[model samples]
Target: MTFVSFLRKNLQKEIFQVKGDKLIHVLPLAKIDKREAANYLCVSVSSTNDVYITLLNVMEEKTVLKCETRHNWLLKDLKLIDGIDQLQDNAEFCLHFDTKIFNLEAYSTASKYAFLRCLRKMSSKYLQYELQWIHFDQDFVGKSHSLLVPDDAVLSMQICLEAFTCACLCSCF
Candidate 1:
C-alpha cells in the first residue's frame, strides 16, 4: 500500500484495537453536503452509542459480509484515525474533528477509474484531491524494498488525501 493508504490501513486497524476509555466515540456521518469540495462545512454531529449495535438485526438476515473491519460488519463499519493533540482539550467551542473516522468495509478492490468514480459519488464529500501517484512496498521506508503497483492502496490514498485536505480546510475556515 502507498504510505498514505498504509497509514490509513494501520489507522483502521487501530480503531478496532482502541483500548478502554481511549475509544473514539461513535457519531452521525453524513453522506453528502451542499458545500463545495474545497471547504469543510461545520455541521453538528449527534452521538451514537448503539451505532454498531444495529448489526445484530442484519446478521441472521442475509450475507451482509462484503467488506468489513477485523471484527466483521454489516451495512457500515466505523473507524477513527487522528492525532492525540487535536483532541487534547475539551471545553466550549471545542471541536471533535481533530480525528477522522472512516466507515467503509475492511476490504475492497477497485481500479483507478472505478475508485475515483466511486469517490466522486459518496466519497467523504468532506474532501477532494488531485491524485499524484501511488507506489507500494512491504516496507515503504525501507531502502532495500521494491515498490509494487498499488491496487487497493491507491483507493485508500485517494481517501486519505481527500480527508486530510478536508480536515485542514475545516480547521482553517
Candidate 2:
C-alpha cells in the first residue's frame, strides 16, 4: 500500500471539535496569565493542508481566537497529559509556543486523542519532521511528550547543548 493511503487509513483526517467550559492562557512571567470559568468554548482544527486552530465562543457562536502556524517551525512544543487537574474531569492538553501556552481540555479522552492525532499528522507533514514520542515517568510527572524533530534535529539538540555548556564554562573564567 502507498504511504499516503496507509496514513489516510490509520491516521485521523477529520476536523476535530469539542465543547468545554474552561480555558487557561498562559504567558511568560513578564505577562499575566488569564483564566476563564463557565465560558463555553469550541476548539476545532480544519481538515486541510493549511491547518488552523479555531477557538470559538459556543454561546455566541463567535470566533474568539484563531491561530495558524505560517511557519511550522514556530510551534515550539505540544504535550498531552491526563488527570493533571483533579478539578477537571476531562482530558487536558497543552500547546506551547514561543509567546504563549494554551491549556485546553477535551470533553472526553477519545476526542482528545482524535484531535491530537490529527494535529500531529498535519504538523509532521508541514514541518517535515519526524515526531518522537516519549512517555514521561508517570510516577513523577504523569505526562507524555510529543516532540517534532527533523531527522537532523538530534545533531541540532546536541549542538545547542554544547553551546550552552560552553557559555557556562566561559562565564566561569
Error of 2 at 122 (Å): 0.5
Pairs that clash in candidate 2: none
Give Cα-based local distance difference scores for all models: 0.27, 0.37
Residue-by-residue lDDT tens digits, candidate 2, 55-154: 4321112533322222222222433323344333345655555466566565443344444444456456665664332222222222224356421233
Residue-level lDDT of model 1, residues 1-173, one tens digit each, is 55334433433344334421112212112223334111111111113321121111011126322223222221122222111121222111111222433232111222222322222222233233222212212122112122573434554565588789999999998
Q: What's the lDDT for candidate 2?
A: 0.37
For model 2, the superposed segments whose C-alpha errors exceed 4 Å read 1-49, 60-90, 131-173
lDDT of 1 at 104: 25
Candidate 1 residue pairs in backbone clash: 68-106
Worst 10 residues of 2 by lDDT: 22-31
Residue 2 shift from truth in candidate 2, angstroms: 32
